[model samples]
Target: MEFAFNEEQLMIQDSAARFLAQVSDSQAVRTAMARPEGYDPALWQRIGEELYWPALMIPERFGGLGLGFVELAILLEQSGRHLLCAPLFATTCLATPALLLASNPAVQDQWLDAIASGATATLAFAGTPGLEADNVQAVAEPTGNGYRLNGQYLQVIDGAQAQLLIVAARSPGSQGDTGISLFAVPADSPGITRHTLPTLDQTRRLARIELNDVIAGSAQLLTDAGQAWPLLRDVLLIAAIGLAAEQTGGAQQTLDLTLAYIGERHQFGRAIASFQAIKHRCADLMQQLECARSAAWYAACVAQERLDPTGDVGVASELLEAAATAQIHASEAFFTCAAESIQLHGGVGFTWEYDPHLYFKRARASEQLLGSPALHRERLAAQLLGETL
Candidate 1:
């Protein structure tokens, strides 16, 4: 099968790279990260209007551009390279996919429309890492006409800017994932509170969210009780593919930056890039970055095919393997490239004023955002062995 990007996808990738390069420089990202909202509203609005990146994957019937996830992945790569501090990922990659997988008609006409039309959203899926599999940290109780939710999500990306809060909460009496469901909570809902939390990657903000008896109408429910995990699994696959794409982009940027630095830095009246050892290191990083790009792109292709892992064992295994492979490779490549780039830059790379550390911090933070490389490898191994994860 052909693996190269189509003409349109290539155009999207090139245009996104150019747009981000022109507008989202390091200074712009720094300014946005320092803001309370964690992004420049004007820039976000302009991209939504001009590029429709947020609506790329939403269906045309739902007021979207009707593009595929590959297009979205292309844009995400550029976002990672520029460290664009925005709610784009929270809205497009996370919330949009959650709604799409929800398959609720009412949700489509209401919340999805707003999101496709450029509203911001943040998804609270699973509690912080290290929770027991049997543990359900958040719950929603049926209240006749609606539901009452009580729970705390310690980490939410861009919670402050999200106009919609998509929460994954379990039914009070249900066990494990069976009792879980998806709900779209208005950000201003009463009994709900959000506080920004400092993150290792300043470009991607985080927040702590608490809900105590937050009331929700039946119309607000996105998934039937106990049937949301399958949908969530699909969403996770898509997210992994998209994040892999972003990580590939970050790795590429790190390599490019390091090469430029080494070429310009002279030692003993000769450019360091000409040294054999430095060239070998750069070549190794380049190989990693290229492999990551291939893996990420292949995963995106699988996601675009709309494979249903739950329907067929072969499909499930393939999808899981593809996502795990892409995520593990991309995560390792980006972090390795970031770390080596810094070390290669010598003393200047460690300082706050220098930009490599910013990328290094992003690498370290993203390595754990979804699941670490080791975690992904463990899951992949379980699948390959035909054992439970």
Candidate 2:
């Protein structure tokens, strides 16, 4: 399949790149990340209102641009390049899908509108240090006309500022896969508490939530307990693709920055880039980045095509495979590229004052988000073998 971006998509990508480069300057990102909030609400509003980022993922009926995930992925790639400090990915990509896939129209209308209008939301998944998919442990109990949730959910991205939470909780007495139900709980619900967690990547915020008898009304359940699996899986899969795209962009930038630095910095009366070792390393990064971009773009294309209501089962498999491939390649490439970029810059790269470490921190933290390479590979292998383990 030809995977080159079309003119419109390229334009969007360029615009996003330019916008993020202007808004998320290195010093600004550093200052925002160093703050207790770990992000800039003003910057968020600027992107959401001026750039219409939050509305990009929502359907037209919800007062959004109704663009496909591929476009959003392009924007996110730019976001990663600048390490934009906003909850755009969590709210627009993760929580929006859960709300859109839920069975409650009223809930969807309310949350979707809010999200499309720049209101932030988050997905609360319970996991340990270096969390992966299938690490969730939150539980729900069926009550009269509602469900009572009690559990500790960790690493909720942007949880401290999320107005709504799209939660996946195991329901008591629910049999089989149906036992897992998704909920749209308002962040201010009684008995719900949030504690911000310290993180290496100060640009992205995380929180731990404690819920005690947190009542989820009937309107809160987005999908039937049994039917939420497919939707949740789809959401997570797309999220993986989105994150992979971001990592790919970040990797590309690191490569560019390092090569530029090497080209300008004179060593032994000549530019260091003239060295064979540096040239070979840059070539290696180029290959890795190309492979990552192909996977990410292909995944985005498949995801966009799958939006058609009549798409075949192969669409699902392709989406899974593409996302898995992108995540694995991009994660490794970003890490390698980050390390290489620092090495290429010599001692100056190691200092906190340098911008290279910021990308390094982001690359490290983002590698484990959503799911890890090991986890995604296992899932891909299972799917490829026609199993669901």
Candidate 3:
């Protein structure tokens, strides 16, 4: 489908770019990442209150701007470009989608407002590295009052700092997607332990969470017992699209950084960018960035359509394929551009004083965050072959 940003989208994009350029510069990013929280609280508050970015896609009834996925993608792209150290991705892309997809309005009414008003949240769904049904190993046993959860979640985005934790678990003895459930547990609840994990990408923080007989009352249940896989699956697809947009932005920035370096660096009394080899390399990076950006934009459009009930629902079926395609392309593009950026910058790229290494680390980390390119390809293949995932 033909896709282009409208006037409003362009305005949002420009505004995000300008704001991030000022508040999320290289020095600001370095400062934020050095902190235990991984972001400045004041900056996060400004993002929610002044920018209203966290509420961009939430429904107006929920005290949000009631925008769509495209707008969110635009904002995320700018965030990725600036390496914004915030929980926006965890709050908006991961947890918010799960809350929005849940069938329970009570759950939505309880949490959506909090999220819109700046309460951070994250989804702790993967007990393992892969994004598959079998990865949900957390077990939830029914109690007279609510439920008792016992399990561990690894690599939860912003898990250490989020105010709310949307956890995915399954009934005892249940396997695969059946008997899956989601619970909205307070991060400070009893018997819950969170530890921030050391990561190569210091720009983003991930945590390991332990839930030991944690209580989740009935009101905290986000989905019907044993019937949350579909909702979780859709939420993951939307998140993949959002992440793909970020990767595309990172790729563009890496390419731009490389170009600037090559143009200014002198080699044999001439700019390195004037060389045929460097020109070809830059051209290839541009090609990859453009392709990745195109895939992300298309996926964003498809996602927006799927979310709109009055839109052509037929396009909704393509969401899975679009998400996988976008994820695959964007992941590869970002990694390639980041690696190339390092190489193009000579020795400084490998130094801590330079910015290329930071982007490189983020590229490698994000490629495995949601799912690897190989995993996405496998899912895409299974989807095309009509095989169960």
Q: What are the lDDT scores of the predictions, listed in order?
A: 0.83, 0.83, 0.92
Report the number of the highest-lDDT candidate. Answer: 3
Candidate 3: tens digits of C-alpha lDDT, residues 77-179: 9899889999999999889888877878988998888988999999998888778889998999999998899999999999999999999999999998899
Write candidate 2's Cα lDDT for 267-383 as tens digits: 999999999988999999999999988888888877776654445746876878888898999998998999999988998998988778988988999889877788888978997
Off by over 4 Å in 3: 309-316
Worst 10 residues of 3 by lDDT: 308-317
Per-residue C-alpha lDDT of model 1 across residues 1-389, encoded as one tens digit per residue: 46877899899989998999988987887888888888999998988888888888888788888788778888989888988888988888778888876767898789777887789997886665532234347888888888889988866878877999988788877776687787889999999899999888988888888889999887787887667777777666777788898888888898889988998999999999999999899989988888898889888877776532233434544777888899999999999999999999999998887788988999998888777889889989998899986
RMSD of each: 2.1, 1.9, 1.1
TM-score of every candidate relative to the true structure: 0.95, 0.95, 0.98
Query: What root-mean-square deviation over C-alphas does model 2 reach?
Result: 1.9
Error at 348, model 3, angstroms: 1.2
Candidate 1 TM-score over all chains jointly? 0.95
Model 2 ranges with Cα > 4 A deviation: 127-134, 173-176, 308-314
Clashes of each: 0, 3, 0
